[model samples]
Target: MQPFWNFPATAGGTINSINNAGIETFRGNELDSLTREICQNSLDAVKDEEQPVIVEFKQFQISRNQFPQRDELVNAFNKCESTWKSKNTKIEQFVEQAKYILKNDQIPFLRISDFNTKGLEGARTGELGTPWSSLVREAGSSNKGDSSGGSFGIGKSAPFANSKLRTLFYSSYDITDYQSHIGVANIMSFEERPGFNTLGTGYFTDSHNSTAISNLLNLDPSFQRDETGTDIYVTAFEPKENWVEAIRNSVIYNFFITIWQDKLVVKIEDETISHENIGTLISKLDDDKEEYCQVKAYFKLLTSEEGIQVPYPAKRYKKIGEFKEGEATLYIMKGEDLNRRVLMTRKAGMRLFEQNRISGSISFTGILIIHGTHMNQVFKKMENPAHTEWEPNRYEEAPSEAKKAFSDLRKFIRETVQQQFQAETTETMDAFGVSDFLPDTTQVAGEGDEKKESLTMKIKSIAHKKKEKPKKKVKKKQQKENFEDTLEEVGITPEGDQAGHSNDDRNEGEGLGGGTGNQQGEQGPADEGTGGAKEGKGEKEKNKPIDVDTRYICLEKDSGLYRLNIKPEKKFEKGKLEFKVSGEQSDYILPVITVTSNDIEITSIDKNVVRFVNLTGKKPKNIQVQVDYEQYCVLEVDLYEI
Candidate 1:
């Protein structure tokens, strides 16, 4: 019979040290980090057959007798509980739960498995580089190759931290070896016994001297699955309420890129999570939240070329500014859907930094995927234990090759972002008609070839001129007359004042006589009003027809509809009003305008000109028009009074 446990005395304090070694690096979401870590490990373990990796999570109940060394495990748990003197509530709670699970007939266990990949293979007791040695024996070993997602090997601690008892069993089958290996390891916070040289580490196996696991003996039937791959059984598993949903969301959000690429398949029990149905899964979450929107936007941007490509320096032999051509896809999002920092990732598709110093507006959320052959090595050395960010000091003090490469990359990213910000700001300002009020800051084409004054100098010159100008005071009546004159020059008739005449002056001739001053009792024009002809300057001006230029009309597209705001250059009294639309295309769909105001009524609709009559018998107010069209177009309006 095998000994119940074999605790190693040499690796003392390893459990506490590794358990506390920056496991809290992932500050976003614990389940998200776990999903990312597990998937990354499985992806890294893919076989050369080009088969897609399959990962699964399941929870089941098993009896204590299901373990091969059930009797010894129970006794060990009892002894550890009795000797534990720590007052920590978490430790005490964990010990109590461990004891109850061992004492009970049936206990819960969480099984995380991966298939269609090269299982943990290689020598079990030899030097590093082998999967068994790297995972089971060593800490902080760099067994993964450059292409592999993991390097420090501390990712294995995730499962242990998740387990209540910090106890988990490993089962793997390597097709090349034609043998299956099963082992159980428990990392306890307290010492097992006194003067026993136990380091709170133990393994369940038949041979006490060997660290390799050949079989689970009696428990083989219940624990073993198919031919190859690895199955991790976490004993005394601590699961939160609705853990399945939590895990599902995490897998979808963090590993959607991998799944979308068809490189990985994740399943939680019978429910398979793939890119095809991820939208449905996301719908179950709060779709209005920023996190959900960010995920949606990420997928949308990834599939399409909707982002900027930033090229950085990639050199071969440590040459400064000798670019070898490597590009990063930068997606600048709208609104504060995510953190206002640059999300940096490499070829593995795993997000490395949630917050990088890409200073900008909080309304901007972005993801930057750095792509190149040499980036892995460059980032590997700079990654901290938490895997959150690159060490700033390392980049500052590194060799010339690394320093220059990193510096150039940072410079390119910052400058690209700055340029994008400037462009977006300019676009928004133009949309709001800010340029009409301020001096145009747009750089003229071909101006780069000529020597020009700096913007600062021009601004200073303008300010100096303004300061030297004299201030004058004018009468109120004179100012009103000047404004009306300016309006007339632009073909626009002021509303309250008509050609320098006030409302009282314009209505003076009205109601003066009951009818026209005709010597003989005769009817004037049949269309004339009962008040008769005023013959004032306002009446003469009102009788004359006015033409307006529709070129100033603006078309704004919004949510499958175009809103047209028409600002006619001039106003006219009751007459035939014609609106001529210029720049109409063959495929352009004219929008049906619904009159939102009772003051205007549509007379006739032609191909390009929409004739409408102002019911108030005065100048028409600004018209608001809406239309649904497949394409966004701008149409110039030309108003004519016939």
Candidate 2:
């Protein structure tokens, strides 16, 4: 045998004194979160279950201590008859029933697409905390089907919270050959205060109702029977108002709609809400296909100017119809059902202010597909981020991956919003109706550099084209001379040149100098007589004027009659040109000096000289331009421009 080598492991004996640092206790909403975790487990376990799982919702009474309203009821119902007592006893019965159903039931109701079953093979159970009460969530696992977000039991809370009275469930599964058994569990909600905290531990518990139905079947020899399952029923649950069919639809739109695929089927009450089926949901992303992106937006309503400066940082409310602008309230939903899980639009549009309300906020939640590809920014103007709310979810502290994804997605969303509103606004303005309102903020705020560049280029082209001088008019006499030169070379001449013509006929092209020696000798007599002396001086001066290369460094202030300034350059020249001025650097230009009188004309001309008089009866503001260097200009602009 080989010799054994062992080293003692270090240990601390003060178990009671040492703090419990390694473990975190689940509490409050934590339990509900854990239920969600367990629901996932059950959904994964049903890979080969013989039958589909079923989900049911039912309501029972709550225990006096756990119920938020129990004490009030106990005081009122202290005295009662035998039958009344039997019917009303205490709230404990329901709590025990709910617990028993979760612990003992072999199969739990499973939710599978629109065709939910009583229960499926491999049932799982868990518990969670609600705002008002605690709930036990049960679900059946799936072996070969689409996954569910609600499988974690948090989904089950949706129906319970929204329901009014009763919920039900019925499930069946076969554990032995030719033997079938069916089980049923029901759920409901009750109000309770002083509930659990972040850790799942709480004094409040669920008010629930549960029962199991079992039997033996498979009588017909030709018939094939499969695995075991359970059933559930949610009765007396309140469906959302007229516009919304049910809470499930709202859930679909808010969270799960984006996952719609061939394999997943969703419904609103009895109405099928989504387009994609369960099969499509199960397929993995195609290698060549671009991944989906998450949408984020932070929004607020503004009635006052102050609101404009404060950035809104609030989450989307789960319930619809909570925002009231005036007499009407706006509702958000996907398709018809408001509760169904569905995808969010990149940019959402609404006639927000028309109905009297000023603004609203919305945020999107989903898994986004991203790659190394960089996203280009789209804004109303290259410099503006205020025009649109891009990332539906932006926070002060966020993960790097999330930050990058949101940055790209925000640009796309902002661009889309701008385009949509711009097109609509143009179409609308062209039509007959007048809109006495401001344009939607989302469309106008965010514009990127691309748009600004295109605009700048167009403006520059127009400016350049305008600067070109017009072409000079050519004379017919010059044309005729050129023509005669070509004709002589080709040995051809006009009839008038070859023969002879009357004075009237000859005068038609007289200035052309087509005649022979006598006329050629006198050709300059008419031009010389018209203006002989004036031409020589102009020709000499056009070639050279003394160049003045002085730069202006001066300031001006308004005066009663004329303007005053410290002139640092020569008087203006007719050929003076100004440099380009852009919005970004427009402030470089010095403040204009207002003219006080119309008589403001330079009475004296000298370097650093300015003198004028108010000839007009009424004095007007005098105006003058001041010149400064780049450093001076930068210092003069308003604080906001920086």
Candidate 3:
């Protein structure tokens, strides 16, 4: 039997009166709800499982009546003369379809047992969570989860601000008891009842491994839950044009605070990343508050090959005030233990990779001053519950209080991140080793000495006393003859008593008493025969001066080596080196050079009035001159050879 097609009544009509029946407004609050849910699952999995959490995204195309074409849409717009007559069928239908997808499709899709596996539930021993809890299971508070960042309860609706489509999330969790899976399904649409936006829970699923589960795998094998971990799935991940990085960064930033403290291993794909430690972000109580508050600036060394001798003092507290020009209020804290803590900073500036001032997360920790404290806030919105958290009123107000907090926190964090990023970039360009990029951490002077002193005191207290008194010596004529024979064999003069001699000969005619002593008669007081003074003088000569300069430039200086060529048409008297150029600048001429006592005495300078000055004041005895014409102009003076 064949089916017959039914035609619409207005199929042949102009249809000039179709009205726009969908919603027109969008709010970010809804997206926040969705973000909270996603973050909650990630934090839970990380805290409960291992590293490399996997998130899965699934998209289901909505089924709806085919909408009108572009020409029809344009005709409809052109025919309308006023607001009362104007029709917006395209946008209106899209909104309606979006709403329908959320309610009918997405909500139902996530509830399937195959999608929401039992691995997580079983592993957790039914210690699962709903939408409102923190991941930490403390004594007083619940171990389930918390809604701090996802506080507003509107996070589920957050996605609507980005798209009007079916959104689904699937996650797999690894636990000791058993691995588990959780799925979240939602539809974003306009509710006709109140003419407002809403999110509907479309579906949920949970189960143990089975054929049904294998069919739902959407992630790479690396992301598959082989061990204890979690996977997040979002089907139809409709990302805005420029929001990909923002959303990813937001997720990562929030993830650190929520789960980083729990010692969970984290990764985006294969690359391992961690949060800056809390202890490294704060200053010590004994530290100079003024210096701690001062903005610290330095280029961070990058690359595994280059090494930097970092001299920055470590801090132990978070500083919140700007103590210098062009620097923001920098905060430092030790997020974790000494080894785990990282120093982080936010900066603002442009670079080749970044079009504008690029901002994100940078690791800065592991310093001495931050020996205490364990709450580090480096990335934007990652810390500060007032900012990262969403509030209900935030959606309705233009400059919402929560949003203002976010902005402020964002500014603070951006600077820190920028600074770190620049440091990394600089290190990369300079090809410095990773070791030298360490933050300047303050050290406790004499800490080692104190420990050593304590140990010495302990040893002295445990040691035994010395023996009583020494025995008297007996001299023999045969012993003297043997000593003389030994000296003669070794080619030394028997010395009229110099070899195997008596106390008189040892004293060498000095007077032990008021009167001079002879070779006999007890040798006066025995002190005159000894040559102790001469031996002391000989020992002093062993430490005589040797020609050596302690100052020398090695690979470290060469690591950041850069040459700037300056040429002067005419030589000038002693003054600061300055020059001007004009027209098609082609060739570079070596500049006339001058040096004062303050300037490091260079080992060598170019003869054409060009000389290299070492600002470090390290005088060298030799120098090597070089010119790189291809670099446009660069006058290099080798200080090592000098």
- Candidate topping lDDT: 1
lDDT of 3 by residue, 1-642 (tens): 111111112223333222211112224333333443444434433432333333333333422222112123222222222222224555456445544443443221111111121234332433334211222111112233222222322333333334443333334443333443333323222221333222222223223211012123333332344443344443334554433334333343333332233332233332333434312322221234322222111111111122122223232222321222222333333221111122332221100010112111222322111111121112222322223322324334332443543344344434443444333323334456865865545557866543332223334456678976534232211222333354455454311111111121112111111111122221111011121112333431111111112111111122222222222222222212111111143212333343233333343232232223344332222222232222322222211111
Model 3 per-residue lDDT at 105: 31
Candidate 3: list runs displaced more than 4 Å. Answer: 1-45, 48-93, 96-166, 174-185, 188-200, 204-223, 242-642
**Per-residue alpha-carbon lDDT of model 1 for 1-642, expressed as tens digits?**
544566556435443422345244543355556677788888878875365688998888777777557666666666556555464555556567777777788777778888887777863443467887787667677587665677777787677666656667777776555344445554454455554435556676556653556642223334556656777777776666577888888787676667776777888978998767766675566777766666776665555455555555445544322434664555665444444455667656665765444442323556666655456656665666556666645543455666655665565655565566533333333357766777555677777744444455334443334545333222122122233244455453212111110111111111110111112211211111111122232442122333331211223344323223232334544332222122422111243444344556666443333446665544435455544443444442323342
- The root-mean-square deviation over C-alpha atoms between each candidate and the true structure, in angstroms, is 20.8, 29.5, 27.9
Instruction: Please give each candidate's TM-score.
Output: 0.59, 0.25, 0.28
Q: How does candidate 1 fare on TM-score?
A: 0.59
Question: Which 10 successive residues of model 2 have the least lDDT summed?
Answer: 350-359
Q: Model 2: how far is 536 from its true place, Å? A: 68
- Two-way TM-score contest, 1 vs 2, winner: 1
Q: Candidate 1's C-alpha lDDT?
A: 0.54
lDDT, residue 68, model 1: 51
Clash count list over all predictions: 1, 122, 120
Give the clash count for model 1. 1
Alpha-carbon error at 449 in model 1, in Å? 41
